[model samples]
Target: MPHKDTQGRRDSTGGVGGPRPQEGSPRGGLTLSKPSQRRTGRGRAEEELTRLVSEARLLEGLSDSLRDMVMRAQAYLAELRTAGSTLENLAGQEGVEVLVPIGAGSLVKASIKDADKVIVSLGADVAVEVDVEKAKEIIGNRLAEAQKALQDYVARLREVERALSAYRERIRSLLEERGLAGGPEERSK
Candidate 1:
């Protein structure tokens, strides 16, 4: 229930009330004013701040997850490069012979088993090892870029959280120091 003063007006309940004369307004002046509607404003600001804080925490979690993905991508790229190098070396051994023409714009096929077939196109014949390594390098680079981008996002979210914290603190201090809702002693008794 809202308290009321002797004037039949709603007391200092610190919430919305209908239009009323401003305190100390001259009598018989026919002047009336409505109380400023700030409760909704304050509530909206608090909700926004809470949303920012939650988003910041989510970003932090995403950043951590990205770090793991980056490491795994790097490892996979290294493994692919190593395997490509080994294959190139074995293809150059005595058991490996160029059965077909080994030149640009040509197709070469090596028959290893009765049903196993390996088709080497012009590009593959010339740069099979390099292509594998290049692909791995590209994937690893992209993963690193993604990790850095996620970290940047997390940092931006943290800045927003810090700003919200400052705003909340400022509002709290203002309300406390001003004693807007009666003084501490008055409320206690």
Candidate 2:
């Protein structure tokens, strides 16, 4: 059974009160409840803003990484074209002596036994011998696949950037509404 005050109202702490004064406060002390509630609300808003800012930064970083990947893919495609041309030129020379690099700037003079056959890497440490035209076709197919993957990455990066921008705008509006839009230092109080 709960205790009752003189006015017949049940009191949890057995104290008669309208609004209880906090201990150690001045005479005619202020209530603790309203101020604590305000602080809780403000703290939650600040946390949300911080989270939004972090997400935006992550998205921006991802966009930059995707751009670098696209550039590297394009460079690889150019190298493949150069390699294909070199292979085509080699096909015309049958008994010509060539300097084949063994390792570390060392070269050995070698005669072309069958210049028409080219070794193509199929990934995973596996390579197969194929004709020049077939090697070109394989390189072309790989380039097309890389281009498609690059396009997909670019599209995802754009989406993340747009989402980040929207989140920033929302955070700005929230801060402005709370009268803390001046800067982070101003909002700390």
Identify the candidate with maximal lDDT.
2
Clashing pairs in 2: none
For the record, the alpha-carbon RMSD of candidate 2 to the native fold, in angstroms, is: 8.8
Per-residue lDDT of model 1, residues 1-189, tens digit only: 566655567645655555566655765443433334465455555676566556656655665665665566566556545544544444325445335557785868674331122232325446332343454455456556655665665566566556656655655555544454356786577
Tell how far residue 10 is off in model 2, in angstroms.
23
Tens-digit lDDT track of model 2 for 18-134: 544455567666545777767867887888988988887888788789788878878887877777677768867889998888999899999988888889999999999999899
| Superposed model 2: Cα runs more than 4 Å off | 1-40, 95-113, 177-189
- Clashing residue pairs in candidate 1 are none
TM-score of 1: 0.34
Candidate 1: lDDT of 76? 55
Q: How well does each candidate superpose onto the true structure, as a TM-score? A: 0.34, 0.62
Give the Cα-based TM-score of candidate 2 against the true structure: 0.62
Q: After superposition, how far is residue 71 of candidate 1 from its true place, in Å?
A: 1.4
